[model samples]
Target: MSLPPITSIHNPKIQRVRALLGRRSEREEQSAYVVEGVRLLEEAAAAHLHPQLLLYTPDLAPRAQQLVHTFQKAGVECLPLAPALFASVAGTESPQGLLAVLPLPASQLPSQPNFVVIADNLRDPGNLGTLLRTSAAAGAQALLLSPGCADAFSPKVVRSAMGAHFRLPMWAAAWDEIAAWIHQHSLSVFLADANLGQPYWQVNLRPPLALVIGSEAEGPGPQSAALATGYLSIPMPGGVESLNAAVAAGILLFEVARQRAAA
Candidate 1:
């Protein structure tokens, strides 16, 4: 096997990686995304994804060293990078000094999804990312986002998603398109709301079901709201208006998982 290559920050390939790191369009155009941190890298590799390139700083731990060689042996082009340069390209505040360029899976949603979460106009990156992460962990089959929602594959979102992007099938479309998809699949669309809705535990989440959670600033969009098969909500004490988008989604997704597993 060829030894790893060492390159400077100004190298053309390195610059391209950094540029792609910042732009969602570039990531889509290249059909690859930058995965940072040791944990995420491990998840990507454990998922059996072949990295196009793996970049790491000199301070790589002994475990990271083993991974570098293993990944290199698996045909990944490992690049040794300077810590300062790695930090310059990282999206997180505490740089992990390691990242990989991974091609995203192009799996489309199933025609008839057993379970999913429809995100509408969700603007918060952290919330969206956490939702993706939780959805993947809870074993949701897919995620469909409305036009105004945060970009699922954006750097911040991807970082928060961890390796969820690789694990979950996702699509971004308009509310009308999403509604049409639900009907075509004969899906039971459940809209999560704060009022005039049954408690989530009251619903049967098994079979064809799509749970909808709208933007924090506003609830589900008009189209999804109108088409919702049922409006669902979690019963909360203390007179709270609602929970955070991420928390609410986690609850709903696990409920689906609970129902599906029991059934």
Candidate 2:
């Protein structure tokens, strides 16, 4: 099939990409997102997530051209746009002139998973994404998202995740549903908080565990607060209030990985 030419800035597809970059509602309505730059598109393709449509500048990055050809042979809609038009739709100040509207993964978390990371409404994209990267590194089975967290698919979150969005099973749930799953799995729910309970290293994380991190500003929501079996803290010997949420989560997740490895 001949690839369709996107010659005009007013093209509906171009308009859609612009809207997706600017507004969350457009992404929600279309079940699409603006994944820009060569890195993201390359990783998405490596994960076998063929995009519904691959849009790039007429001049493609040399490293990305092979992947573009692969998509074309796979029958995905792959083509280029005007450099000026592509730049207007790209998110970053320095545009890579490459992007795609890939479908979201269909994998859901197991009803009672043995190992998991529960994000209890993390508000910061960078924090949430770092948690995801940490979880993947620590060999956690999946990432379970509770209410009030940033959209897992948002461009900021995706960029911060550093390829984790394609690597792990990520799912969303209500607090009650997550709570019920915790109880059903006999999983120990550990909440990481700045001021509370035992130091994180003292906690036994080898068993089926759902390690929960909370919002950056307010910490965990009331539902998560009430549901925590116990709270764990990391000592700040330097008189700091606390580490950033992602830093804290990375420390705690590695702790869990350490305990399991030792056991």
Judging by TM-score against the true structure, name the best candidate: 2
User: How high is the CA lDDT of each candidate model?
Assistant: 0.82, 0.82
Please write out the lDDT profile of model 2 over residues 1-263, one tens digit for every residue: 55555678888888877888777777778877768778877788788887888887767768878777878888988778878877777878888878888766776777657789899878888888888888998888899899888888888887888888888898888888878878888888888889987998888887888888887678877887777788899999999987888898889989988898899
Q: What TM-score does structure 2 among the candidates reach?
A: 0.93
- lDDT tens digits by residue: candidate 1, 150-176: 767777898889878878899887777
Off by over 4 Å in 1: 1-7
What TM-score fits each model? 0.92, 0.93
Q: How far is candidate 2 from the true structure (C-alpha RMSD, Å)?
A: 1.9
Q: Total backbone clashes of model 1?
A: 0
- By TM-score, how accurate is candidate 1? 0.92
**What RMSD does each model have against the real structure?**
2.1, 1.9
Off by over 4 Å in 2: 1-5
Model 2 scores what on Cα lDDT? 0.82
